[model samples]
Target chain A: MVESVEGHRLKLLEYEAKEYFRRHGIPTPQGRMVTTPREARDYTAELGKPVVIKVQLPVGGRGKAGGVRFADTPEEAAEAADALLGMRIKGLTVEKLYVEEKLSIVNEIYLGVTVDRRNKAYVVLASSEGGMDIEEVAAKTPERIVRHLVDPINGLRSYHANLVAKRLGYGGRKMLQFAAVIESLCELALEMDAELTEINPLAEVGDGFTAADARLNVDNNALFRHRELEERLLESYRGELTEREMEAKSQGLTYVELDGNIGIIGNGAGLTMATLDTVMLQGGRAANFLDLGGGATPERIGEAAKFVLGDERTRALFVNVLGGITRCDHAAEGIVAARRELGVEKPIVVRMMGTNEEEGRKILNEAGVETLGSMEEAAKLAVKLAEAS
Target chain B: MTRFIDKDTRVLVQGITGSQGAFHTRLMREYGTRVVAGTVPGRGGQTIEGLPVYDTVVEAKESHGVDASIIFVPAPYALDAALESVEEGIDPVVVITEGMPVRDSVELMARARLSGTTVVGPNTPGLIKAGECKMGIMPAQVFKKGEVGVISRSGTLFYEIAAHITRVGLGQSTCVGLGGDPVVGLDYVNVLRWFEEDPETEAVALIGEIGGDAEERAAAFIGDGGFTKPVAAYVAGRAAVPGKRMGHAGAIIQGSSGTAESKMNALRDAGVDVGELPGQVAESLKELL
Candidate 1:
């Protein structure tokens, strides 16, 4: 049931965003990601200055959640890295630490560029109040925030950047510099195909500015054009993937593991969610959520079935398909093939309708696979089978 | 007397040579929709299933005087196709392409608004005026001509509810999938407005899921006397865990805003009947009716 337009987006880590900033001549504190305490200590020693050790997680509110710490010495940096590496922030374990030279901030300014859904344009938001949650600022002090909508066709112009900068109370050289920064950030957002590119607390250090913290969310739909980013994402999440999930990803299937006994599979997202809801209503929990996507072939269905059946937690399998473009016969063939190839003994309940459903049901019935006419009946049977098992 | 489309509505199929375009065109034609012309860039003079194909929406409009366009263009070219229809002054353009880049959708929606054209679905099943006209990819057997108008963000969920409603002998005036994307051309408010103004539609069934403030916005609109029609609502993804996306790109609970419970509460507060299950939607609307 994956919305073809809304694919999974990947959030870049702080260090990754810093790399992009460095490439684009945007000022950012010198930083490198360290997976080990020794590496963190070495980087701190090389910098010869006080540094901030931040837990490298893709989630927000890191500072408020104790994911950010300061270290004045190499020993302290190592200790901080040790404390953060195994820490859990927002359900994700911090396996790496971004150790960067801490900068003296005279003022904190916020700069962000995101697509404004209502306006249907890219909006660049800037505020004098930074280094804090922008949402909180918007709620508490709405006057501090200034928003400028950039035309998608004309792109972000220098005048537009200056307008935003001026609104944020910048003037003269600082205004020009901030405008330049906003322009560069907009360029970076365009280059990276980002849904959001933000620099909270763009630190005003000495006579210039440096992005103290950076956040980037790359659009998943546009990821096909950016293979390197996809590779990096895969590499970063290499440790998080279960064997089945990894296999499914390789085979181009959307699979999410859940703690349940009934493995649920469907053709579309809406149908899959409804199937999950129905399973729960029938006193059953789904083991996983698997979508075969649109127009699944027999081979692809077989592969998906094999992956689900192979899960040790899965006690029964429920395949609910309301086929439109997806031919039901192909789905049936895949299920039958998986049953024979994997020799899965789990009770499989298949409910399919639309697009050659009769032929599909015939194939399933011929293979001795149970085919139900309704999703409700199929869910009840799957739950019954799971409970019996 | 459907809301947006009818048997007399002159239809143009965009990307007619494509597999989905050809398939649904035949289905729409079979269902009695006047599919006048088709647009397929290079297949201008070619005929597919006896429908004349044009190179552009302008060409199709100039020749056949098309009123509405059902787009079957791929995701990459969906914006251009929709814009083409909008530029040609088509009243409503139904885009069936999925996986369109959100940025492109934003641009297309903006242009559509400027041109005073209505666009539906960059990733949706489109719209069907039960028994009369079908512009989407939904199974035609499930819908029957009636007075209830249906709007949903999820395609399959809309079908499920439509099927249940039909099974319960509550046919629909029109059913629309707004496309389950973070950004879409039309929202619940737009559809609700149409249903409210639609003399044929007595009641409306809103199928929403966890994500975005569209449901809440719809509730607010209804509360502000925007929609006078009796509204029955069903929200999917009740079992969906937070942060984890359940199929629909826009069906994720971000913070506390887009939750099934929250949406239900909002709708209930707005004096709309809320169904606990898809099967219960018909019964819920019956209470209001």
Candidate 2:
């Protein structure tokens, strides 16, 4: 059975990251982190000429998102700052603005070290060509991207860094500088228990290296040994992240916010995922994917149901579980308890098979929650209910 | 007649002072496991639920001759405990802890292969030999001594198997959770091989979930060897297709290998009797018996 405990939050901000890279001798552009629009405008004016006023959101792609803008004139810079300071990038509202003198760069490169989702190993990627958008870089000039999969046991070696730099078509001194920065990046990644650290346009400026756009993600599970990372993740929750989400995360739950009418619940990861896909397949979007875990209590189930419905987007709920290590009877009782406590006016479609399923189904039917026999049927019912509601 | 565990299996609890370690250790001892010792640095020489504690696996091994270790340590420390157990030569290590970092699990699991040590779980529930011995987190009351052997990747689902087995008078030889992590020590093929060799394990109840190619591989092994003993398989997450990341760092299925469909198809191809109902395990056993 798939289980839910909360998963870790991805924590790292641009200002903190820039400061970190700067200290490590990786050149960052002349910039200021300002919370106030006045500070943002003033910094742009002081920087003079060509400047990039970017929203300091935790998520990626501020440039394409219009969260990032450039202005040649002072008034235009001020206007851009005002527009982006309050804007949202990928659902995260901008509370701070980073106004920086856009560096004069001859070359732009993408250097990143991220834990492979499959192997959980640190993988580094580098590519030459700065200033262009990363997506365009990925799509059109994909051959420019060079990759190195570092064995966690062996770690990132200097020779490996040199290979990536060389493959990016960088020659001699620039290649050496890039290799040196890669080593520094590796140190930062390993020391921080980082899941990812991407420096798009790690520029080869006049005699130095600077990361123009930085994206770093630290491994959440490894945060116990890293109290520093815990502080980094805490920034996103500065009243920005919802309490429900934070609670779900802290408890090791992998909660994704979706715009759907049905709240999907299941035990195993596969079933929970299927429920979401099936909801969409039947022309219904899912509000959330909540796995109450294999051993979730009736009380936990009720709380989860309440949490899912709390989004105000949910009109119906779907619970799919095939009990194995967890008894189906426990799941049934949990659903019953949830229904009684939450007074679920929302329609529920349950497909439970395995381990005391009959007893579990009996509890659900008696509780008046509609129970479906198949996952496909449950998804269809949930979609229909959501549409009707 | 459990294959992997019985009353004689000398058990050691890693992170014996933690909440889970404390909780399940008591239950395991109460269920009649020979929990000879525990490990929790400073908590050594102290007692929890009346079991002796040691500072390290070495101390536990020297003093108690702990052959198997039931890990209650947290995820970060799981690899350390697993490695230490192997270093101290603890056989059949049962790691009940979840959230193990994949890198460490890979190293430890790899080490397990090299050292000839058996590792049960990084996020598994553990193993139990019906009434004779309870090595994992399954409820004790559900078990009864008999021939059917239950094996799963999840701990909670196995409880359902146990209850059904209990109801049908076909007690479990032992239920093992290989854990749901992507890089685990044991897989379906490994466990099934053990079950095949065990005289006490007659009809086997193989419980699997929707990820990993462990089942496909297991089916191949079974097909090649032709396990004459009746094998009952129940693959959960029937409709599960979304990429569910591993909760247990060890549990992951890459490429096209470990999907639920592939595992199910593998079992079907192997000519193993698969059950749709939990109680159908008993029916399978009845036909074989």
Candidate 3:
């Protein structure tokens, strides 16, 4: 899950989205979340049939990562579960497994609803092709993808859904069923404030459609209106977040860990990113990205500084501040506080300007931290110092 | 000569009784904007900083001919504030509230489009015409009156670039922040169109970051000769790793799209000067002018 505009974006795992799908009257295969291999075997025996064990991680292309396995018996279910329980896919460990009864799928179709940022509207995308990455499909076979923009006020109407269904080659009773599913998914997306709700491979079982795979990305800013949903998914969302991410989330900071040696801290997302880019342009890699949002107090800055430096991979620290709402003197004081607190183990370079620049430079100059006026110059110095260290 | 706000433009402040609303309203007033009146839900007949406060946008609009509105209402109630202003035919509504649900923004944008009202941001620092009018939360000290028009996606970065431009003896005609959310009102295309029409704007400075194809679309617009002015652009996030969001909600690379290299190449292809750093944008613009 990524930090969104105002809060942390929560992407519900397949099992979690299926839980929501069942609650919203969308047909889905019966499934249970199991943590251990014994539980997976027990669930398979209870179902009295073949099952598919899927590792739960908030990432795409799980099947390509060998995270999905099929088992025909209870013993095979346990073996598959054992193989997947501790497996790591896309830097996230498989802490839990979802076991569901296998379906005899005759055909597959793709259906999804999401906000189209460019159009500034809600859009419904459907295709006859399924179980493939939608982006890949859109790029290779754009003609196969059918799009319908929903009216923001009136929402997804029956006629619109019917038109998309017809375009996807559905007709008669199956068309109606498919149209109803579209309407239901649209309603669900709207009600839940989902950024995206997708059902890839809406598997055809005889006459009806079952959601073979589910994806739901809820808007974190809208969580206030959804207390029940937040309560239900908060623990799982916490499990998905890394330790540093949880710390950043609690402290109202935006932090993303990366593989590098230099610790980077800056004000605003754009400046922080630009600082990271500048650092790289100077031949230095950043260990993490940290942004002190608007009105950042000195204490918050110090806390973020300490957190970034706490990483064992970070050999040097670079604090870049273009103070607008953020005060440069405050930023400088925070850097000083951090150095005093951390006992001066790492090389530090500071590029401070705007809003109390003179006072900020004075503070940093007195603290014996290397300070520079130009961002390029500071980045170069940071790269050299990090290399030397 | 400015495209959005000017000294004669009568502005209204929504959620004027709130702390952020009240504070920025004072700053706007001090910056010489004609902040005529304000609106608060139940603060009718009240006065903040000697400005009259109304109970609703309708009351404020009826009382004063509000040309534009700057909203400081919190996220949950910002949608209502914006809708009220749009329904009243406020030409440009600047939403400074962060944490707003994008769904609410989409709904508001639909109505604003029908009303022909230009909405600035749902999470924005706002816009300013140097030495003339100010809207939103950007620091007013760095801006100096000049002929260059600036459009940006980030706040502090805008200030950084603007300060650099000012230091280089080239000021600005107008500077607009298009907001930092995934969905925002008035992207590079809209502002570039306005800048092309504005007589005072001789050149343009565009500060963009990773995310969306807004920069690419702007490049296409310029490449197709939709905009004729010389544009200098600096796109952030060149070193951003794929799949990791770089602070902003929209500043992320999915698969191979929305990369800084892609945006820069597009701008360069359009015959625009694409800078390697923020300060280089000002240097390129100075040379172009």
Candidate 4:
């Protein structure tokens, strides 16, 4: 799994994640993200029962943070939405609320499927004790959790799902129903290219099961194959991007904003991270994390340089590149072009090596940009320059 | 003797017609790796850089006696390409493609495990046996032939440390890039074990980043005392923020689990000399040696 330019998984909202469950034939609480109190009231009135108003923020632990509330009446639902709409949880503002009919939960079970990297297989985790904290349950009552590794070639078979359900103390019709949920979850995970798909608290209501909450993280790398999913993700993330971030996204560059004086740019993620660490170690804080990626052209590098140095907070720039697939000359040319066009006054410390190093250094020298040979020296110079400015 | 690839390795380049594949194939060939053939479906009988091209791994193996396959397929097609090599019973398959889906990589790993085929990466620079043979995108100029074995999870960091080792007049037996992805083939433990068994490798330079417990597990394996080779490590991402992925899919601080501090402490506890910076690795290795 390679990180997208944005870094980390694109976490789907509760409503969004549940939609996958619903599409996969798993029973999920009927819900939709409502922006206003009127929409919440309208949805609650249609349900005609006690509903849950959950603040839709892309973070976990909303239940304990007062982001979730039960509304018995339409008016209560509207009030819950009003109270939650403008609230913030985990630094993310709650602009929407997922309104769903509340299920009378007799039992809560947890089921999750993810790649077991060390074991090199797909691990399906099931626990009878759920809804609260699965980690706590695994730690306190380890036997309550049943772990099974699915064979990659054969995938999660019906028998395997039945075994998981049987281990969780389900038998007869209930066992069959629970097994279906497991099978559906597996299918959803496989079809969606999901890195992690979890149904925490698969509530037992009367005779059937309802997915109370779900967490689905699709692989960003595979998003190219899922155009509809990508469009949906973009629709969900419409208002989340800053103006600069959106521009970087348009250019297909990974740029993460930070609060510092030095702008950091590198070719690879690992190298960029190491540059950040070196800058910090030398008493310089990084203003952003910008990766040019492999096989970046001179034009792309120049665009990245302009984008990063455009930030007003940046007093100095550190361009650390160890070119393998990416040629150092291309990166150098880009930096030179950015400096000329943007008329950047900040001190730009560049450290370049490997793959056309001599030509890259010559280009930088001709552009009046002194390049350093070592990462440590370059980082120190950048920090000193930032402090001087 | 190197554990994976050597001069005799008859390499097959998957996706040989692609830009990256064509470029690195020539570099590997120039570096003395026996790149016997290439595979590009529907392009069978075509030749790239004088190397014969086949439509499938089976066809390539039949005609050229392929021992290893370096896959340069795109992200979406990487799993299928790697699996094809595994099915063909390629001894060691190196995938240079990055950004493969984690689920797909997990499946590839599982299949490779069952077949006992050693897979290298879905997002890596591959590996090299110094001056003898190379199967990756690493700059050959930075590497020298000698006894120090190198294994890393980061691409650029690996090059940086290897350059330092070369500057200090040291060389490597086999330098393996375990990949920057969260799910990868040939992790730290796998390469470390091989380094321990290889008599030519007297010391090892283990480079890791924040995130994952591979380094911690490697430390545990070393702490068992069965590994006699002295190991020097450098864990990057010390300045990384919590929960932010520092480029690599696996390089992130997930709560307090995968921190640079924690990894360094673990390595230190296991009697591995840990460096604070990439350049300091040479000093640490000098002390260990």
Using lDDT, give the best candidate's number: 3
Writing each residue's lDDT as its tens digit, candidate 3 over A12-43 gives 88988998888888999888999999999999
Write candidate 4's Cα lDDT for B1-289 as tens digits: 2359888888999999998889988999889999999999899989889988999999888887998999998888888999899998897999998888887887888888888889898788889998888999998889999889999998888998999999888888899999988888888888877887888799999998888788889999899885778899998888887766667777777656688999999999999998777898887787777
Candidate 2 lDDT over A1-389, as tens digits, reads 11111123354677777876776666678888888767766777777767887788766556778787887766777787778776766667788887788777877777877554334356676767555644466567777667687776667889888888888776798878889999888778766666566687787789878888776666666677767666666665543345555776676565655556788777755346545656666788877767666566666766676677666778987877766555667877767777676665878788776657789888888878777665667777888888898
**Backbone atom clashes (below 3 Å) for every candidate:** 4, 29, 0, 0
In model 3, which residue pairs have backbone atoms overlapping below 3 Å? none
- Which sequence of candidate numbers ranks them by lDDT, best first? 3, 4, 1, 2
Work out the TM-score per prediction. 0.89, 0.74, 0.95, 0.93
Q: What residue runs in model 3 are displaced by over 4 Å at the alpha carbon?
A: A1-8, A36-48, A71-95, A231-242, B1-3
Instruction: Give lDDT for model 2.
Output: 0.71
- What shift in Å separates residue A378 of candidate 2 from its native position after superposition? 8.7
Compare candidates 1 and 3 on lDDT and give the better one: 3
Docking class of 4: medium
lDDT of 1 by residue, A1-389 (tens): 01111225667889988898889889998888999999999999999999999988766778888999999999999999998888877667789889999998999999988776555567788888888766677767888889887786678899989989888888999999999999999898777767788899899999899999998878877776678887776654443455666677777888877789999999878778878888988889999889876788899999889989998899999999887778889999999999999987899999988789999999999998999877888999999999998
Output the better candidate (1/2) by TM-score: 1
Top candidate by TM-score: 3
Model 1 chain A: which ten-residue window has the lowest total lDDT? A1-10
Task: State the C-alpha RMSD over the true interface residues for candidate 3, after superposing those residues.
Answer: 3.0
Superposition error at B148 for model 2 (Å): 8.9
The local lDDT score (0 to 100) that residue A88 gets in candidate 2 is: 60
> Where's the lowest-lDDT run of ten residues in candidate 2 chain B?
B246-255
Worst 10 residues of 3 chain B by lDDT: B1-10
